[model samples]
Structure formats: C-alpha cells, structure tokens
Target: MKKDKNRYTVFEHEALYVHRGEQKLSDAQLKAFQLFYKERDFPYYSLVHNGIRFCEYVGVIKVGNLTIEVLPKADKSNGEEHWRSILIDMMRSTGLFHPDSPSYSSLKVKNSTILDMYLELFATEVERLMHQGLIKKYRKTQSNSTALKGKLLIGKQVTLNAVHQEHFYIEHTVYDKEHLLHQILSKALTTVVKIGTASHLISRYKRVLLDFPEQRDIKVNESLFDKIKYDRKSQSYQTAVDIAKIILLNFHPDLSQGSSHVLALMFDMNALWEKFVLRSLQRNAPDGLEVSGQVSKDFWTPETGYTKKIRPDIVIRKNNEAVAVLDTKWKNIGDANPSDDDLRQLYAYSRYHNNVPSYLVYPGNENKSLSGMYSRAFVGDAQTPGGVIKLKVHSGKRDGMELLNQNISAILF
Candidate 1:
C-alpha cells in the first residue's frame, strides 16, 4: 500500500483543477489530455479553464502514471468510498463487471483504485483458466517442411525446392493455443502489466503471464470483440472474455507523447441509472405485469428515407394492455418540477400509447408523488384526457432498490 501522489479522486459533476503550479499535471500530460479530448467523442468530461469538469460519468481515467477516479454522488454528505461501492453495485446489478466484492479491510487502507479492481478480477480469471487448462484450436500454417504434410503445393515446392532438393513446401493444420480468444486475453494481461499502478497486483499479473502460453498479439479493438462467437467448448470463457473486452476497449494509449496515455473506464450515469431501474422493475414485477425498456415504435417515415423511431425509457403493461410509461431521470428534482422537455416527452408517449398514464421518476429524499393532467388546450382535444401525468421520486437510507420497488408498486399496482 504505497502512497501514490499522482492519483486524484473526485465525484461526478465535480472539477479537478489543473492550473499552472496548482495541479501536478505537466505540459506533456496536458497535451496528452488535449489530444485525447479532441480525437474521441468522449462525453464524460468537459474542458474547463483550469482543468476538466467531469459530467454524469463515473469511473477511472488513467493518463500515464496519473490516475483520476470519478465517482457517482447522490448526496453531498456521501464520500468517495460510498459512491465507489454504489457504482460497483450498480455495475454488478447491470451485469457489467462480474468481480467478487473486494474485502472491507482493503477499503480502510485506501490503497486500491477502480483500475486495480479490474486488474485483480482479470488476473484471477486467468489463474482459474490456467488451472483448468487453456483451450486449443486448429489453425492453418504454411511453411517448407523436411517431410510431406497435409496439402502439398506444387508451384511453391517446385520454386523453393529447386534450390534445396531435400525441402518440401506444404500447408497444414496444427492444433494449438494460438487463437483469437487467447490473443485477446494475452493482450489484456500485457495491458495490465504496462499501465497498472497498484503494487500488489503487479506480481499477480506477472505470475499469470508466466504460465500462459505465448500468443500472437493483434491490434485489439471493439470490432474484434464483436466478432467472437462462443460454443460449448468456449462457453467457460464467457465471463473472462467479457471482462477482457472492458479492459482492452476502454484503454487508449498516447503513442506520440512519451509514456503518456489515457485509459477511461467511465459509464454514463444516466444510462446506468435507467438500466438499473429497468432491471429492478423486471425482477420484481408481479405475475400479470410486463416491464420493458427502450420500447421503440416508428414515429415518422419519409417517402425514401428510413423511418424514425421513438422510444420510451420504460413501458409497463398489465393483462396485455399498455398501462403506464415511466421515464427515469438520474438527477434529483427535490421540491422542484421536471423540465418542460421531460414533460413533453412523456406527453408524447402517453398520446402515442392510447393516452395511458405517464410518470417522470427521479431521485430524491422520499417518494413525494405529484399528480397532474394535460389540459384541454395542451392536449388539443375537446375535453381533457383522464390519463394522469405524475412525478415520482424514490429514496432509501439502507437499500435503494427496495425503496424503488415500493414506490413503483404504489404507483402502478
């Protein structure tokens, strides 16, 4: 547990200042950040005069030896550790990273960063895989062999063996560990070795690499992971491969600058929050009720172009009929009203879904449900619609998911 002076921790929607002689950022590091910001469509942080202001995205950002961890916050009194744990829980709930919980003793020492958690999980999986034995696949290879093999190439044999009479050119299939899955895992292990700052995990990483077989490294990217298809033989590697994708895809190294790189493992809080609520509702919904998120329907279609779709965040149905529409917001609108855009969006959902009830859900101190209705002028109808538009908020001191279930039950059930 050595002290890392280069690490900085901040909450979401907070700023990490980097003025001259103010923050420890060097000129090269600043340029690296600038280039990273310009090259990618990263929406997690916005550039400020002194430094970067993190938005509603929470995770770790490593620039060379420097580590910046942005954590989620619901209340100002909550510290970084609280939000870090909550973030991990949310990710687990959404089936993102499947790591076992880190011990409480480690939290007290204040040594492990988010990146360390990822490396630990990845190394642990690799260890398990090594003990079980790495899977091998048959790959095609071509070369000049002393004896004839599977397929003899007449043209190559005549051209190359003309010089050496004892040689034979052939193409053959060899069953071994050199395959796509091994290549991906090997690349991820090397990535951990390169940028890892946690002292304890370095030895674990090296140990895993020692037993792992050599693999031909390919340029890892998002598409490479998408191209993978798992079968009965490779099903055991699903969890390890999922974790590997998170590690390799989020990593971006600055090649032009010396030893300066940027690795961001941030998740959009808005998207994560929406997904959390959707999962909770899906799991707890009663027998007859159906819960679906991002239910899209065609909104408009041109004569020649593609049709536009309108999706509601959450749609609730009972007995095969659309009953309610819910739009979850991560921001707290305590004692205040939701924005006009939010109301309008819900209104559109209600109108399109046969005027079923709509509600805007937010995070707050308690479930202070507000009820209202669309007026005649607003609805553009002869009489006002009976379907009510409401505001719902949920808060919990012990378990947020339980409170969320109670609030949703009270509203729809």
Candidate 2:
C-alpha cells in the first residue's frame, strides 16, 4: 500500500520519516515542516522510530509543501456533550470571539474531524463579520461601458482594441471593491472545505460563497487592508477587518510555494494556554488588581544604550505596579517536576522586576509545590532576589464553568 505523494499523516506526538517515507518530501517541504514548529519555540518533529512525531497540538496546517495527517490526542473528551469544548474554551479565552458572539456558542469538538472545528470557528467568525456588512472602497475600474461613465480607456483607442466596439464604449467607473471581498471569502471557504470532510460545512460554506458568486478568486499575498479606509461611517467593519486579517494571513488556496500558500488554522497550544489563563484571570480579577500580558519592565541599558527587555507572560499589577507574575505552560506534569528552562525563565522575570511573586503555571498537577532562589551568586541573590513557584491550573482539560472557575480561582489565589 502507498500513500499519496502530497499527503503526509501522523498521529499526535507520533513520528514519520518525511525524507525517506512512502510520501517522500523535498528539502523545501521539510524545511517548511520544521520552520512552523520551530517558530512556536517547540520542536516541530522528533526523530523517533525513524518517523516525524508532532507535539500535542492537533489540527490541519498546510505546509503547502505537505499536508499534515494529524490524528486526535489520546485523551478523549470523556464523552462530553460538546467534546470540542476545549477548542471553544481556548478560543474564547483569546478575546477574539465575544461571549455574545453569534454562531459560536454551540460549536463542539467531536470525536472525529477535529480539524473541522477550526474551520467552523474560522467560518463562524467570517459569517459573523459578513453579517456586520462588508467594507466597501472605491476601486478604479476599466471596461467598455454601455453608457459613458467616467474617463475612457483613451490609450486603447489608437490601439483599436475596444474603440471599434461602439455598443460597449470604453470608460472607467469608480465602484466598490465588493468583488475583492468576494474573492477573499470564496478562497477561504474553498480552503476550509478542502481541509477536511464535513457534510454540514459544505452547505454553510456554499451559502457564504454564494453571497459572492460574481466575485473572483483571490491570489496569495493579495490583501486590501491597506487599501480600505477606516472611518466612523465604516466603523461597522472593524470586526470584519480583524476577521479578514486572520483569514487572509492563515487561509491558502493551494499547496504551492510552501507554507506561505497553505492555510494554517492551527494555533500553538503554548500561546493559547497562556492567553486563556491570563484572560480568565483578568476577567475574574479582584477589584483592586489588574491583569496584563507581555508587560514591559523598568530597565536602563548602560553600554548598548538600549533598555534591557524582559516580558513576563502575565503580570498582575496592583494600582499600576506589578505585584505578581505568572508564566503559563501547556505541559502536563503528572509526576515529573517542572523543567529547568521553565524555572529559569520565571526566575529571571521575577528578579528583573524587583523580586515579584513569580509563578510557573502548568496545566497538570504534580501534587507538589516547589520553589527555588536564583541570583547573581548563581545560587542566591540579595539585592534583586527572586524565586519560582510551580502551580497547576488545567483550564483546557475539561469543560463546564465549574472547572474553569476553580482553575482561575486556584491560579490567582
């Protein structure tokens, strides 16, 4: 038996040899494969059993160079009604989807076709934005007009291209870029449907695409963000602009020129986990405190004349002063302890900010708490003293407001 040359499949954390497998990949494709994971600060693939093993993040991402055959993770959704609740919850944490957002609350991560979940979420957002009214911009148009409209295609008259055709006179018309909008939506809809098989998606997407039936297909690198104007009259399109940015950047039409042309609806678990915790804490934060992410620090650079940079994942500020810092990791520490890399990162973030309460938050509990000191002495510090606290808050593991409420309560308290 042989797999398709363009398709490459592997289970979560499983491995396959792309260079020497049945679906042998080229050097460019392999680089694209490694680049995606590496950019997220994770080892994209592991050389185990002579195959490429993916990390826990499961979804379809086109390397265009290759189609990742991603299977689901070992942990089933425990037969929860909305098994895909994890994805929904994680996405909700990003603040991209408003709590009151329509067409999103009912989404579920089913046992099979998890990739479909991403498509649905993306489409749901797209549809929501479409309902808000698509942004329109005056685009210069050139065609033979039945009646005189604007400037004529004057240069073409000497060329005798359209001048001879009196019935369709050459003229320019400033029209809305509705055609461009259609192209973008059509391309994204086409890509999402092709990503996976879902009977329901076809109709939903068909409806969306049907809205822009007259519009053409957009090409790679074609974007209208810069071309469109943002004013009070067009303020309705803010959400559409945001959604369009995500779709244009992640959606792809074909597997050409590598990942650039491939649609990547997948999200990095590490980032998603961190954002979810931060947002959860921020939303539920006490009245006296505030939660912020990637907080800049107070530092002065003497030699380079550039301020020393250190950004903690989530910083809890009390009345504008950072009181506590929390770094979220998506790893599970069932029995094994937190890794040194995580420890050092949190320790430095603490020390750089006047010895604040630095904490390491993992999704799983090791049933034990540990702390250590780091300083200039390489063992301890006195002036800028700091330590690391390992804590667990599995917000993504289970559904229901109870677990989420508990996780947030435990992490913050």
Candidate 3:
C-alpha cells in the first residue's frame, strides 16, 4: 500500500501520542483531526496538543480525503487479522449483513484489506443489481399542460387557472427506471472516484454509474432513503438497496451541517456489540423466553399523562413477564470492575421490571466469573417480589456468543 506522508493512522479504542520521533502534529493537522475526533463522540480528543490521544470504533474514517482506519489493536501474538475474523463473526451473529457479502470462500486466502473487502462486495452487488435492471414505477405527475394527459382536473380550480390560461390541468403517468437506489449508487461511485485507491475497480464502478443519462444523476439526501419501502414486488432489490444504504450511511462528502470538505465514516462498537448480544440471545434463549430489545415500561403514570419510561437494552420475557434484563457493555472488564453507575442502572432495571434478574455483560479474560448484588434502598417495599442485579465478566477471548450462552444459562436454565 502506498503511504501518504500527511496521513496519520490510529487503532480502534486505542490511545497514543500523535507524534513522530520528537515532532508532534502541526497546528493545522491537530485542528483537522480534532474536528473528526469530536464528531465521533470520542472522549477527550478535544484536547488538541502533544500527546493528545484519540480512539474510536472500527471503520475507515476520513478527515477531508485522507483515510484513518481504526483497526482493533492487537498484540504481536494475535495481530489485527485475527481480530478482524472475530469482528466478522460478531457481524454474522447479528444476522444483519449477509454472511458471504464479499462472496469470497475464505478470509485467509483473500489477503484483502477491510476497505478492499467492502469495495469488492459493493462492486459485486452493484453488478448484480445492474444486471437485474433498475426498478420501474409508474409515478403520476400533475401539471398544467397544453393538452390533456392521463386525466384532466375537472374542478373549479381548472376553470380558475387552466381554462383562463388555455391549458389543461393534467396528471400523466411516466415510467422508465429512475429511483433513489440508483441515485445513491451514483453518488457513492462519485466518492470512489475521489478517494478510492483501487484504480481498476474505481474505473469499473464509474462506468456503471455513468451509463445512466444526465437525468438519473439524481442527487439524493438522507431523507429520501427514509421514505422508501420495499414490498414483495421490489424484494429483488433488497441486496443492492442494503449495499447502497451502508455506503451512503458511511460516506458524507458535503453534509449540510458540516464543512463541505469534511469526511468521517465510523461504526460504534458499543452499538454493534449490544446488537450482537441481543441477536445471540434471541436465537438461543430457552423455550419459554422471548428476547426483545429497547423494552420499555412506564415508570410513572400521573393523573394527566405518563412519564419516564425505563427502556433497557435486552429484556427476556417469559409468560408475558420480564424474567431478565441484559445490558451489554463493549468495555473490557478485566482491569475495571462494574462501575457504581452500571450497578445503579441495573438496580433501577430490577425495580422497573419487577425485581427480575438483571445482567451487565462485558468483555473479559479467560478466567471469568458472575457476581450478584442486591439493593434495598432502590426498591422500597420489601414485600414486593422482584429485584436482583447480576453481573458477568464474560470472556471475549474466544467465541463471544458461546461465552454469552454459558453465562446466561446459569440464570435461566
């Protein structure tokens, strides 16, 4: 890989001094990195000075057009390649992204960088989508025209404007093939042309995007993607649509709120880890348990209205009762024990969910243990049935889902 002298790289969830030998980041470089650093919500990257540390979730981030890949830091014994494998496994556990997205038989053989993998997968999906052709919808357009079209407006407004102007208020049905998916793909391809490293692949995608006429150069914003829905008729478009969604979500060239030249694309490990755990439990919960996320119940219902809904991450319901509440934290639990804040939160969950078992799951070393605690002050009436907070420092060293199952089995089965 060709190196850019100006480019500075860092690892995910890592802390390091931004220095080369005795020389630190120039004032301008510090300013630029600080902007993206703050945007990621990473704590303390705001302190832009010598030895100022920065870390964030995994993905290729950008400051302007420069790439800053946040690979998970690994020791010499394991290295980043192994960690990437684990990350991929976590993704599969979620059942969100396709298992064989890159369509490669094995990761070991591919010897591909993460960006390479993303690019290859995107290219393949685009090729498949283009082969299927764009989806066509007969959209009805209304206009005041010289001649009648599909249907003429025969109301008072027609007489007020169309008749006086000697034109017909018409609704016309036009169909070919132009949609937000293609427009998003076109914009993403434009990004590739600007920042992509692979010359051959960039050329290929550029041609595919340019194949459409000028009318299809359709600029798409985030709101456009939100209003779109897919039904059975459009189900075939799911793969391409998903790819476009990921691409657009990660890439932002000229956002309305930020600098026109600013670029930052990253994934939050906390969110990803939480989702992975939820999916795992959803798939493996006991026969009686139903795994649900963002489970909320009103804490206070006044005479007028309700307030303060306590929503926990994952709640295990059995026989329409919350049996357990699970909160997955991305931090490693080896060095740091569960915090007072975490314990208090779990205690609150215990009260909110009728004193059910609550868990705080975290990354751990090989030797892991579960700890349980009780809070008398939080839940006032001793007579009420539920309120136990349990914490498990589960090992992320091996198969994370398996580790989770082993930990959760003690409480449920």
Candidate 4:
C-alpha cells in the first residue's frame, strides 16, 4: 500500500506500512485504505467512525484505494437512546463511569461499548482542543431538561392615608430670632465652633443649666482666698489631662495604618488572581468537566470540635472524580517556601478529602522551586514529597496565563 514517500502506519489484520510521498493520494487509493481500516483505532478512524457517508463523500482522511465515507446512524424507534445507554455502560465498565449510572440503563447493549469507547477518545480530543484554544468546553449540567421559571406578580399598588398621626408627627423646626439674645448666642456659637466641640460644650453644661437663672456664675473669693488659695480641682484636672495626653501619644498609629493597608491590598490582589486562576481552569478542563470555585469543607475533631473549615480556590471534577484542588495565595510565598501554616492547611484539605492532590499556587518568584512538604505538624519539617505542590506563577517575558495553562495541562492531562 505504498502511494507516497511519507510512511503511514496502519493497524489492521497486519500492520501494513505505506509510503505516501511526492505523489498525492488518488481517490481509489484513499477509498481502499479507509474501507480496510474503518473500524480500527487510529488517527484517521474518526473520519469513518463519524459516519459512512462522511467517509465516502466528504473524505476527511485518505485511505487505500477507497475514500472514507460517513453516514449518520438511523434514529428510528429507540435506536438513538439505545446507543446512548450502551455507550454509558461501556464507559462505566472502562473506569470512566458517571456516578449516576442508572441513567444509561435505557441505552442499547450493542452500541454501548462503541459509544463509550468513542466518548473516552472524545474526552482526550476535547482536552487537546481546549489546550489549543480551538474549541470551548463546558461541563454538562446534571439536569439537562430543567429550565428556570420566572414568577410574574400581577397586582396594583395600594394607597394609604397621607395624614400624619398626632404621635407620629416628627417636628423638625428651625427658629431664627435675632431679637432673642440667648437663641442668637447659641446659634452664633454653633456656627463658630466645630460640631464635635459644640456637642461637647452642650453636654458639659446640660446638667448645670436647668433654668435660665441657674446659669448665673458667682464671683470668686479674690482677696481673702488669695493668701490661702488651694486649687484642688485645677490640680486634679491638670493631672488627668497629663495622663490622657500620655495615653494618646503612646498609641502606635503607624503600625495600625500599615497593617490595614496591607490587608486591604492583599484582598484586592487575591480577588484578581483568583479570577485568572478560574479562567485558566475553565479553559483547560475537558468537556463534561465541572469546576467549583471556592468550595468550603468543614471538619470536626473530637479534641477541637469543628476545628476549622477550608475553602479551596478551585475544585475540578471529571467523571465524578474529585480530581484536583487548587489554592491561590497572594502573599509572596518566598523562595524559602511555604510556611508551616500553608503546608498544614493544604495537607488538611488533602487528608480530609481522602488524599486528593492539592496545589498551592502563588505569584512566581524566580528563586523558589516547586517543592513538597511531608508533615502534619505545623511547626517542624517532617518528610519529603508529602504530595503538596508549590506551583510558581512564572515571572517575566512570558504570559502568566499561558504558563499556567501549560502547567495545568501537564498536571491534568
């Protein structure tokens, strides 16, 4: 089966080798090759497997002597449903089973294996397609037939009485009387002083001024008390003021301000970084893959009583397998590597979820190596290769997302 200089390997009754070189494949040569290898598992198999008419007429692949054709399988009676069931069953048997296995019971036994095998292959192709940015992949929703329904409210607005009740009426009055000396003085003071200062003065004098005459101030004993004047109240007030000043001065405003800013910025950066990570996950996941963002899991211990809850940034599921868990850390996870707290958290997630692999994704620092931790203890170093992964979000010259995609693809596929 030699047509050209390039050798095409065929896995058939015999492993036939063909040289397809300078000469282009003839129609008859392609048709013969397709018919011979139509049902076989190879790169060109998809052309024929898609349909018989497709192989014969649209010839996606060149076969020996005969061009491949694809024809749509007949959808009479329950043929389509039967085939779908068969595919599901086969997939289940081959370790790619959906958790909801009963859904495939209606599918035909004969078509199940073939369809399932094709689905497995399709999954791989879908992964490749997603990586190449040639196609968009979405996870199939569990409930395909469900539709959201909007409720319509048909009603009229009810009118209420506009009259205010005697008790309900709130009187907000502003009286301007330049002729009233006390009122004028109060207004002038309010206008001149800051709101805080005015409020303070009003509060201080509120108890003393029960009546207009009670506001009178008596003259101090000047000459008689001048010699033996003991200023007790003034001395106490001065001492209290000195103590208050010392307390205010002791307050470390800079430390508090710096911490507040750092926390705010960390959250802002984390939010942006998380979005990028989610996009990368969505882009790389295969069709029928479900991704959950910020999934929380709560664990309770006998000693601690619901010790803590962990929220992984991303949790990806394929064929109902809790495949990967990713945590995004915005902090500079220095070249020295993740702190003990980080390792404990990730390891707890893994241990809690039956040893699911966990990844700690951080901003790329050229100095750090993607390493693993080995201990459950939060303090000291324990072991090597504890199944923890430190994925650096690569630095400089290359696109971060591209690097992320590459790393994810390698890990997932």
Q: How many residue pairs clash in each candidate?
A: 0, 8, 2, 37
> How well does each candidate superpose onto the true structure, as a TM-score?
0.89, 0.69, 0.74, 0.31
Which scores greater on TM-score, model 2 or model 4? 2
Which candidate gets the maximum TM-score versus the true structure?
A: 1
TM-score for predicted model 2 compared with the true structure: 0.69
Tell me the lDDT of candidate 1. 0.76
Give one digit per residue, the lDDT tens place, for model 1 in 10-123.
788977655544345666666667778888767878887756778998888988888888877765556666666677667666777663433222332123566777776667
Off by over 4 Å in 3: 1-9, 15-29, 34-47, 50-56, 72-78, 100-115, 140-172, 197-200, 212-214, 254-262, 300-306, 375-412
Alpha-carbon local distance difference test for all models: 0.76, 0.59, 0.60, 0.38
lDDT of 3 by residue, 285-371 (tens): 779779999877777777886586888888888899887887777766455557888877877787777787777766544334455
Score candidate 1 by TM-score against the native. 0.89
Off by over 4 Å in 1: 1-3, 20-24, 99-113, 380-403
| Model 2 lDDT at residue 406 | 59
Cα lDDT, model 3, residue 81: 53
The residue-level lDDT of candidate 2 at 365 comes to 39
For candidate 2, which ten residues in a row score worst on lDDT? 74-83
- On residues 233-313, what C-alpha lDDT tens digit does candidate 2 reach at each position? 555444434555665676543343433455554556677777877777877887889889988775556775677777889
